[model samples]
Target: MAKEKIVLAYSGGLDTSVILKWLKETYDAEIIAFTADIGQKDELDGLEEKALATGASKIYIDDLRAEFAKDFINPMFQAAALYEGQYLLGTSIARPLIAKRMVEIARAEGATAIAHGATGKGNDQVRFELTAAALAPEISVIAPWRLEEFREQFPGRAEMIAYAEKHNIPVTASAAKPYSTDRNLLHISFESGMLEDPWFDPSATSNKDMFVLSVDPEDAPDQAEYIELEFAAGDCVAINGTQLSPLEVMETLNELGGKHGIGRVDMVENRFVGMKSRGVYETPGGTILFTAHRKMESLTMDRDVMHLRDSLISKYASLVYNGFWFAPERLAIQALVSESQKNVSGTVRLKLYKGNVIGAGVKSPVSLYNPDIATMEADPTKAYDQGDATGFIRLNALRLKVGSGVEQNAKK
Candidate 1:
């Protein structure tokens, strides 16, 4: 009989490297390592070679950059979903896409089981398993962190390093920087180690090297930069009058936003697993997109429609943050969000300066703003009729007046 095959979500990182070897040894299974390219830049370099050397029988690297941006990141942006009003849902949003692809690879490779390197304590384990269960219920998920045998073999990073050395596995991890980081196209997040403390000041002199995607706001250039974003039906189509694909748009904005220090957030967020975690994130491009998208909506969207959508922001945000991206409710809510964006086409000009994304102007062909009705100048020919004010005000105030009269009668 052929050996049972297991597909592993491989990042070519220290933990996953160790897990790859451990899975082969523990299960005596054929390990197929898979890596998803979601705009990690140089991190993808030498990934396949490393996975192979680490005992993967086969390696698969899929570039899901465009699909990730168009399918996952774009919809989340359209909903204006932000976890805890600060986190851009960078790491949170990427997990579902990775899990989806992992399932696809598992099916294609005829694998009976899939595995991930997410720790038992973190939210990624929930994100990965929930997506897998929702997508492919038949396949087994191997979570090494939750297993007693796995934990006993390698208790910590030091032990994992020792095991890697013993097995001739190439690893770049060290104990010096205790923090771990996750990066993709939208943002890069840092947590664990020194970032575990809720009160840890990332801006302190000792932690100056924590940031990766952006420069320090204080170190940013003194001169401000202005750019215009063109949106069509709630999607950004161009930046500064230059047409670009969704991925290119994000990459371009990241360059500009990072140069100006436009996005840097540090907060303690409530995790779905009933834990509070502190994280530092640099979401340069996403910050620009979120700000400019809202500016465009302000010019084109209806007041009540925007308010109703605003009420669902927290719920939608929770769905994404809690690994419910593949859930039915998220799809239903996304339909409503898509409809709300029918008139969200417009252009917004913004000024970027020292961590500030300031809106300069917004315009749209279907704009609801009527300048004639808003002007202060007195004109008899205009739509404004001053004589109608008294009746309008009286009609609106009738209920208040009636309530006041009722109170006065009761007092008497």
Candidate 2:
């Protein structure tokens, strides 16, 4: 009989490197390591060699940056999905794509089981498992963090480090630096370690060096910079007059936004796992795109349609954050969001200063903003008659007038 094959989502990080070796030893199965390159810059360096040396029979390092931006990030931005009105769902959005690819690789390699390094107490476990459940119901998911034997063997990072040392598995984790970070094309998120304390100030001098994507707001350039964004069907198509692909757009905006110290957010968010987690995120490019897209919609999108979409913003955001990216309800909401963006094509000029994205101007070919009627000065078109206000107000006030008359009669 052939040995069982297990495909593991490998990041070449401490947790995953250890998990790769542990899975090989514990299950006595052939381990196939998979790494998704969704724009983690230097983190992908020498990953293949490390995985092979760490006992992976095979490794897949695929570049999914463009797909990540176009398929996942673009649609979410169209819905203006913001979890709890703050989190951009950076880490939350990346997991489904990672898991989706993992399932694809498992099918190609004929693997019977898939594995991930997400902790039991975190939302990642739910994301990975749920994606697997939805995409490939036949394949089994192995979560080591939830197993008693695995937890007992390595209860803390110290034991995992020692095990790595004993097995000669190279890892970057150390006792001194304890926080965890997840990075992708959309954003980079920092959590755990000292960030677990809700009151811990991430902007303090001691934590200044921890930020990877943007500079501190106070240290930004003294001058503000202006940039224009072009949108097509609610997605950003160009920046500062240069046409860019989805991937290029993200890369360029990250550089620009980072220089201006934009897209730094610190908030305590409720995780899908029923726990409150404090996270600091740097989403420079995403912030710029979101602001520009919103401004564009304001110029082109109808008020009622925008309001109806806004009504579902919370639901849509919750669906994405809760790992239902592939679920039916999310798909239904996405259909409506896509329909709403048909007229949301325009250009928006913005001023980037320090950490603020201030709108300078917005215009669209199909803009509904009729200056003739909206202008305060005398309207030469006479599009809106001033005499119409009397009947309009009287009709609107009739209910209030009737209620007041009833009250007066009762008093009398």
Candidate 3:
């Protein structure tokens, strides 16, 4: 009989590299490594050679950057999905797409099982398994971090490093700096190791070199820069008068935002697994896009419609953060969000200055703003009748007046 085949989500990192060899040894199966290229830049270099040398029978280096931006990042941004009102769900959003592709590769390769290197205590495990469950329930998911034998054999990074050395696996992790990172088109996140401490200051003098996307605000250029973003159906279509594809948009904004020291966030977030984890993230392009999109909405979207969608932001954000990107509820919310964006087409001018994305101006062909009614100096056109305020205020105040009268009567 042919040996059982397993597809592993390989990153060429310490954990995945070691896991690749371990899976081949422990299961005695043919290991097929799959690496998704979602804009990790130079990290993809020499990955194929390393995986092959590390004992992968076959390797798939798929480029999914455009798909990642258009399918995953764009829809998530349309809902303005910010987890806990802070996290941009950078790492959270990428997992489902990665897992979705992993399942596809498994099906094409006739693999019986898929494995990931996500730790047992982290959110990626949930994201990966839940996605697999949603997309391909029949395929077995081998999570080594959750297995007693695997965890016991390598309880710490040192053991994994030693094992990698012994097996001739190429890995970048070392004992001196073992912090974990997840990078993709939207952003790059750093956590674990030294970042585990909730109070650890990532901006301290000792950690000056930690940031990868944006410079420290204090180290940014003294002069501020301005740019304009044009949107159509809620997706950014152009930046500074130049049309760009979704992938180009991200690449350009990352460079611009990084130069201005924008989009650096350090927060302790509650993971889906019910644990609070400290993370530092650099989401330069996402920050710019989010700010510009909101400004565009203010100009075009209806007030009630915007407010209703705003109320669903938390729920939608939770759905994405909790690894339910393919769930029914998230799709329903996406429908509503997509409907809201039909009128969210516009242009927003912004000032980028030292970690701040400040709106300068916004306009849309379908803008609802009417200067005739909104102007305070005079309304010669009489668009908003001054006399209408009396009844409007009295009607709104009736409940307040009734409650006050009841309290007064009780006091008497």
Candidate 4:
């Protein structure tokens, strides 16, 4: 009799490694491990051997770093995507791309099912499942965390540790830290365990050890570094005088920003599963990009257009966080986003210093900022319409003025 094969989205993490061995034992499936190298630096180290040691028949490590930066990160950067108005959606944006690739591999390998380490309660499950549904709905999903046997057999990380010990499966993780973290070049996020406390200040002495990509602000370089970003339709194409690919741009910014301790954010954000989760994120490239893009928008994008997009920004972030990447709604919004970016071409200078990214300057060939129209010392008669603003203000204030008079009259 032949064994059924399942493609697992493996990360060589404790959860996935344990799940890999457990699947081979329980389902008798030839487990094929798949890891996506989405800018996690050295995260893929020794993963192949580790998977094979833990009972995976084979391993696939797909280098999706370029694709992630170009397709996912760049588009989201154009949108200036921030989930819950603070988070840059670093981890949120990476999952869909990886899952798409996983499904593609599943089809190529003739796997009966796709498995993942994502727990039933997290956004990752939604991310993986949605991508699979959108790309390959026929393939079955085997989530060990949701499985009755797996959950019952190992109720927590302790049980999984014991199981790994019993099987002599080599694992480096222990139960010392109850938290979980996810990282990529753009950002590193720390959550779970101690972070579950809403009142906990993540920057406190007890918690200062949480960050990964940065040094302490006090220890950051005293001097500020300024870099100019060139954007073509809201996509960063160059830094200073050097042209860059999407991945090149991020890595450069990450290196520059990390050196200055630039991108560190900690906040309790609304999760897609109707919960407020506290996550500390360090998105150095994203910090510089957002600062530069917003500055450039002042010189290029229309005020009305910027406001319209701003109004829908939260909705866009929510959709991305909730795994609606393939929905028509996201497509409709993204089309408008693309249209808005048509003239978002410019150069923005940013000053990075000790976790602060400030806009130094902005220049654009298509700048809406005309000195002739806006200069304070301009001749009082030409290139402007001050008299027209009287009527514009009157009409705009009609409702407010009338409401105020009505209240006064009633009081009188």
Report the Cα lDDT for residue 410, model 4: 100
| Residue 38, model 2, lDDT | 98
lDDT, candidate 3, at 207: 88
What clash count does candidate 4 reach?
A: 0
* The 10-residue segment with the lowest total lDDT in model 4: 372-381
CA lDDT scores, all candidates in order: 0.92, 0.93, 0.92, 0.86
After superposition, which runs of candidate 2 have C-alpha atoms over 4 Å from their true positions?
398-412
Residue ranges of candidate 3 with Cα displaced over 4 Å: 410-412
Task: Write down the worst ten-residue block by lDDT for model 2.
Answer: 170-179
Candidate 3 yields a Cα-based lDDT of: 0.92
lDDT for each residue of candidate 2 in 343-379, tens digit (9 for 90 to 100):
8888899999999999999989989899988999998
Better of 2 and 3 by lDDT: 2
TM-score against truth, every candidate: 0.94, 0.96, 0.97, 0.95
| Global Cα RMSD, each model | 2.0, 1.7, 1.4, 1.9
Poorly placed runs, candidate 1 (over 4 Å): 379-412
* Stretches > 4 Å off in candidate 4: 205-208, 379-381, 401-412
TM-score top scorer: 3
Clashes of each: 0, 0, 0, 0
